[model samples]
Target: MISGEQRVDPELTTVIESVVGGTPCANSGEFHYSLAERRWEWSDDLARMFGYEPGTVRPTTELLLSHQHPDDRATGEAVIHRVEDGEPFCGRHRIIDTADRVREVIVIGDYESDDQGTVVGTTGFYIDLTDALEEERNDALDNVLPETIAARAPIEQAKGILALIYGLNSEQAFAVLKWRSQHTNTKLRALAARLVEEARQFDPNSPGARTRFDHVLLTVHELVDPAADAS
Candidate 1:
């Protein structure tokens, strides 16, 4: 458990909550894995997502891998191995829950360090995108336009950054970018451009990169020039 001084920023937490709440089809929750202890901790929502009643069962790496779709089990195991080796953990894959329902999810996390500044584990989010996929497919079909091709470059780059950091597919990544654009009152292209520029400086391998990127993603809108967008 995090101490008061080490707690995440309330505003940042609110932003994440809003993002999860705003979408009816998206179910998301936080998780942590302690490297030294080889232990897993799941939020109640995550437990529910796995078709288990909260607090009813212990979360373990083996339990997590057992839930992976047969075809994706190797991929899931590799992600855990990478995290164990002190690398960022990011995976977009499918899993079969206790109810025998298949769900697609994204696991995005970064290294967690102890008070001594030693990397101790990993912490991040699990985002279920099963229902959202159909919605995004319909939106994609409706929005394709020849004229929009010119603006796709930076937007695509921004989407890639979001995908890598958040473990979202291209569609979900675009949805996040669009959400930020609308809420921040920033033009979509301008917002994407700003995000791409800022992300260029982010090094995923660096210590504390995940927390820093979270701040950047939440507040980058403030850095965009409205007048420039207007032009």
Candidate 2:
């Protein structure tokens, strides 16, 4: 037993490790905040994810937020507050790794609470999408059949729109669109049409568009394949 007022399932830790180990372009870490002791616990992999040698740095909310990119720091703080407030948290953010590399990551965590429903801690995984993003940035679009060019025009248009709106490369944009299509039970061309139509209705710079864009990215995590994530 953990032998604390707040107990963690040792098996949950094991499952996290196993899933992360098998997952591509991803790593797992554990965080446990001792509310009473005001202390923090971190897994070695979590340390590495933040560019620390295992067992070297003491983990804290402040230290974690420090690794966030300047633009993402406020969002990181909000995530912490959500955890402290015992809300399930999910977000996309950027972190500066130990070597000063900027890594884009998706974080998903749920709060831990005592029987009395007081917040005890938060645990979750940080999945690195930097590799996929890089690949998207570097790879050229594949050759298309001349006969199929017209059929693919709307798709290409949608890809262009997504690329412009989300700062993704053409291939990455297409991948995201395809994922959304399959997950939503919509046909590819239909989804492509919907995306283009939706984009046309909003000024890209408008706050509503930005908000919807953020929500789209958040929901797209389900569409990301583990293998593609690492690539």
Candidate 3:
């Protein structure tokens, strides 16, 4: 039912379809209304964007806005309002994409007019910013994992050295280093850095690297953190 409170214009529907990504079927053509009486239709892409599909989704503007990142919501809402009021629409905002990935998108919307030139409906364009968002996510992960969690110091250096020589992932190399430290009775981080330095100085294919690593492991364990051997 087109509720008594709102009247949606028709051109907006076409705008959504044009911008929607068919493969992912995300918010391509849906517009929402704040007043309860408004009834509008949505394209499948739009349905998907708001976390719904062809059969089960309820179309609402609130649904669309709710997925917006807090930082982007205000600007997005204001732009939509200007379009609804017959003003030109333009903005960029961040939203949580269907994959729960925060993406930034460019928005451009406008309304249609009848022969009388009265505002009949509105349409909008959305361009995905998933790439930008993905970059942000990667940066955030690097900052958090390398700086906050994990064994803070030489664990990473050892991992890099192992990757440089043995062609192992950081996680795998770390497991090997930790296991070797436990066997030799040494502190994990210090033992890792010592292994890294030895690997840097000697080639693993030469066999002498192993002896050097062991020798340094013993010396560092004895000289640096003495309790490391006991632990």
Candidate 4:
């Protein structure tokens, strides 16, 4: 059992390691903050995600908050403050790394406790969804499509569109598309093609992008011909 002042707990570390290992994407890393010690620990992957060399720079609350995107700083700060107060942390936000790259990430964690069950700190992981989505897009582009281009291109593009708009992982995005296809009684390819075409009209960086996409996603299937085999 870990004592209140213990810097590291082997058993807790093992559990964290197992979770990171089992994650579908390699774009995730663990973190721990010791409230009593006011110390922070970060995995190498997390450091890289923040555009820092592992062990080269110290991790502090200010440094962490500084990396948050301008629009998301308030949300990030709230999560940090809550964690500092021994509360669980779970938030999806954006960060601007050292190289000025924007990354969307999900941070999930719970309060860490000592042997006597006193809250000692917070432990959690960050999943870099932007990187994962980009990788998925690249992989889709690299795939060898069978026969007609109509068979795969629209579906892949549509999946990417949904993933970004809904903050969904690749599998979840695909499942949603399949569900929509079934419910609308439209061919998957046709539905995807219509979605992709509609999505093309919106500027993703705009404030209303999500709202526009939400409307498009809900009604794009209506535009697709149910009898069409290819979009």
TM-score, model 3 to reference: 0.42
Better of 1 and 3 by TM-score: 1
Model 4 backbone overlap count: 0
How well does model 3 score by local distance difference test? 0.52
The digit string of per-residue lDDT tens for model 2 on 1-231 reads: 122444664444544544444453235465666656756676666777788887788877778777889988877777767655655565667899879989886565555667896777665556555766555434323322232255557577777765555445554455556645543445676566555556566677876565565454334444444453443
Query: Higher lDDT: candidate 1 or 2?
Result: 1
The 10-residue segment of model 3 with minimum total lDDT is: 14-23
lDDT, residue 17, candidate 1: 63
TM-scores for every candidate against the unseen true structure: 0.62, 0.53, 0.42, 0.54
Which of candidates 2 and 3 reaches a greater TM-score? 2
Candidate 1, superposed: residue stretches over 4 Å from native = 1-15, 22-26, 140-157, 160-231
| Per-residue lDDT of model 3, residues 1-231, tens digit only | 223344444434333333332234443344433322343455455555545656585655676667788886787787656655655444557778567877666555445455796656654445453543455345444543464246556777665554333333344345445544543457786676565555567666785554354345334444445554445
Relative to the unseen true structure, what is the Cα RMSD of model 4?
A: 11.4
lDDT of 4 by residue, 182-227 (tens): 5455788888888888887878999867646655765677787656
lDDT of 4 at 70: 92
Report the lDDT tens digits of candidate 1 across residue range 66-114: 8989998886787667656656645667889999999987665556677
Clash pairs, model 4 backbone: none
Model 4: CA > 4 A from native = 1-26, 134-166, 170-231
Which residue pairs collide in model 2, if any? 25-230
Candidate 4, residue 195: lDDT = 89
